[model samples]
Target: MTLLACVALISAAISFSSIAEPLTSAQQNQVRELIRDTLVNNPQILEEAVNAWEQRSTEQAGARLGKIIEQNKDALFNNAASPRIGAKNAKLTLVSFTDYNCPYCKQFDPRLEQIVKKYPDVAIVLKLLPFRGETSQSSAQYALTLWQQQPDRFLALHQRLMSKKGNHTKGSIVSALKSTGNDNLSIDKKTLDEVRSSLRLADLLGVQGTPATLIGDQMIPGAVSYDVLEQVVKAQLARTSS
Candidate 1:
């Protein structure tokens, strides 16, 4: 049979199966034979079907994530506790969930900084999420504590921490704090609780890895190219203006 005939046969079989009435044994045999012969002659059709299914699934997932973002806009954007940088009255808000010890997070910093420098009306929030190891956890707790006591020094402390070459430790955290003029800061129960809360919030946002970025209703995971980032930002701006 021709490819077009094969497709029509498959469509007919599907349409018949969807109906309430049952098919006779001969009809079932015929449909099964058609399907088997189609596949044996043209295996590419199965691959095409699988690709279509995967594409649909991805689109559905993106839609669901968009809905989630709209529902949690307050928590994602306006939280006083989240460490923010860039223009305070910016039109665009970029929220990044990162681990101190994540190499990709370190790599992503420059791209993020580049955008911040280029866009005068853009604000970026760095959400501390430590899932690397003990050192990362300690550093995150210290950063959170510093944020609670002195939110102003967060950017400096973050820069210091990100610029460090080696693994983060208690000493590294202290040194970063001191370098950022937060030498007197100490991690207490309140700050520890804040760190835990941030982790819980990350979980709620479906953040499973380091360097997850949220721009408007879109989520970009991992290290992305500047072009992709710029495209998303422009698309969002266009959408809002429209």
Candidate 2:
């Protein structure tokens, strides 16, 4: 592989580390030995290997999600909440797991929109992956209720809430929804009660924070610029298309 390819693979390693939980020291040591053996004579891959390891961040080693993004690509794209408008069977799918109250998620929301608009063939799925405290849970419930009960209205509410001027408080969200001619809608105690009752999807994804995204085989945590995201998405799209 070329140097760029090596970097890309190393990036993948970094991405993997962020999504799933970190490996045990023994396991990491074993992987190091394996690379040493494989690259016993190849200095380039050896360097690549070291860089991949050295560059890995703790965020990359999510306990339940680290290894999931790549291993479960097919299911993620075709799963519930996957987009119906974008490329359904396209070579690329970007799944975002975010919190309504997460400031980073707010920052990422627009960048995500631009990415999808730029690559219409890439299907984007937004899953409610809340990992904060009770407030986050309630926000997620409110959002998901909108998605399930008033999908069209829910997306609008979501975008607005994810904006700088948008409000995250319950009263604020309701008012925003009402202004959108959804006055008849209700996210009152009953609705909130219902949303809080069920949240199996979040558990399955093993999300620990807001603004976590699954781009192809990579799970990116925190806010990222379009430039960095574009490189990763484009590389995966190329790999899939190839």
- Candidate 1 residue-wise lDDT at 106: 87
Residue range 1-242, candidate 1, lDDT tens digits = 65566788778777877885778899889888878988898888777778878999989988888887787677777877777888899888998988889888888888888888888888888778878888887787777777777787777888788887767877887888788888887676565565676687678778889899988877789989889988888887677668
Q: Show model 1 residue runs off by greater than 4 Å.
A: 1-8, 14-29, 40-44
Model 2 clash tally, residue pairs = 11
Write down the TM-score of every candidate.
Answer: 0.84, 0.61
lDDT of each: 0.81, 0.64
Off by more than 4 A, model 2? 1-75, 81-85, 132-135, 164-167, 187-206
Q: What would you estimate as the lDDT of candidate 1?
A: 0.81
Residue pairs with clashing backbones, model 1: none
